[model samples]
Target: MRFIFLVLLALSIALGLGGWSAHWALDQSAEIGTVTIGPWVANPSAGAPDADPYSKARLAKIGNLTLGLGEGVQFTADRDAAGRPLRRECQYRLAGQTPAARVWTIAPYSQEGRLIQPGSGRVAWLTSNNLMRAEDNSFAIAVGPRARAGNWLATAGTGPLVLSLSLYDTPVSAASGVANVELPELTLESCPDA
Candidate 1:
């Protein structure tokens, strides 16, 4: 009787731990094959045919179609350069140059992966071609609920935000590996309540 009870307790504990681990792994955003630069993170193998089983499973759960190996690479930032969470109520500025890509796009999204809608007659996303650059070819974009002069990416509502930067037809997606390239810097300027 004593031996049977001990065996049953051990089995129950093992099953519980296994279930919890599986759930945690699936819910995590960053997994193996992920590269981090400042606040941005990218998984180069996310859309590859030879990706790991865990990565493939996570992508399937999200139902997001990642760029193919030759298509491009997508980087996401949920925080500013100082590692502070990006909030819609706070204003921010993205300044600098992107990697060597033929075309790129930047946009803000909610935590749930939905695009944050901007004010009427305002744009929600900014592409590389339509931006206004400085003399040195650098660009700056103001982000918040209020309007600003020069290039602006208007965001609405209140809550945490995520920024997506997609580089299309860039050599960073080559078969060799992800190159060490510099992405734009996101800095928090101010908040209305602060």
Candidate 2:
């Protein structure tokens, strides 16, 4: 019995030491994974994988991420029948329900995951209840070069575009139900077509 107890105690101590070492490595800047969105993926040659999430030298910045599409969501920019890229447009659409605890937003960003900037990457596409609603309770934002009628998502000078929908204040457990939501196919539209 004593032999068994000692063995178990040694195993526990080894595990605890390993965990602490990992934590220290992360704090000291470890490497992490690259950011990928469908066919468009960013390979960061510099960032560390085990680095801290809050560190400035981390892999990539995340402007938008979807949480409510059943389990997870898939996004592609809306494309024309010819498979051509649509500008000031959403090629991919994620259909999911937002959690009650926090607010959700679908905003445009660049391949680097930074805010698209200047327009759709601006304050228009990214909205909350603080902004005025347009008739329907559902919020809509447009992405493009010039300002449109509804929410204006400014695309600075045109690069690959991506949309990130975030659900703040949501718990990890509640996010599991997202797999059950019957999401709609992402629609292709210019500024107002969708």
Candidate 3:
């Protein structure tokens, strides 16, 4: 009886410590939501340096909790090289090694937390929506003013873009995992001239 009681006490202490550590690490990582771009870097009414203005369910993970945001990264737009409302064509690729949930989505958002001027151009790619799918059942999306046709992610004529790849329904394993996850990089192709 005494041996069992001691083991239980040790397990409780270990769990408590692990949870506390997770919160601390999260607080230290840079805020992924709020990132801004553009010339002058001052125009949006909300504020300069646009922060993460998108509405998304929190991210989840499992295992070591290591996430991969592709090495190639692209930032939001404020102005073009010529300083005339920058525009660009780009693609985003997302993948997960062991996600807790089976479904996921990549949605766009503005600084004010609203979907940009609605259009079929590119709204939300959801598993249930039955749109995005790769050969292996993974997913990818393209973002631009014009439509890429399939897997297109639409953008407003002028404003910052917040792309959120949300993992549906947080998984219990991820909650206990101690690793990071990865996100796709935004590949910029064509930016409007100055």
- Local accuracy of candidate 1 as per-residue lDDT tens digits, 71-155: 8999999999999999998899999999888999999999877889887898989999999999999999998888999998999
lDDT of 3 by residue, 37-111 (tens): 322121111111222322111123211121223111222333333443323333333232324445555555564
For each candidate, give its TM-score against the true structure. Answer: 0.85, 0.44, 0.44
Instruction: Give every collision pair in model 1.
Output: none
Error of 2 at 105 (Å): 2.5
User: Total backbone clashes of model 1?
Assistant: 0
Tell me the tens digit of each residue's lDDT in model 2 across 1-194. 99999999999999999988766765565324323333222212222333335333332333333233233232233333334455543423333233343554556666555666573234635535553454544444445665566555566655466555444444422224433432223334544443
Better of 1 and 3 by TM-score: 1
Ranking the candidates on lDDT from highest down gives 1, 2, 3
Provide the overall lDDT of each model, using Cα atoms, as 2-decimal numbers.
0.88, 0.45, 0.42
Positional deviation of residue 82's Cα in model 2 after best superposition, in angstroms: 10
lDDT of 1 at 17: 100
Q: Native-vs-model 2 lDDT?
A: 0.45
Candidate 1 stretches with Cα past 4 Å from truth are 1-20, 174-179
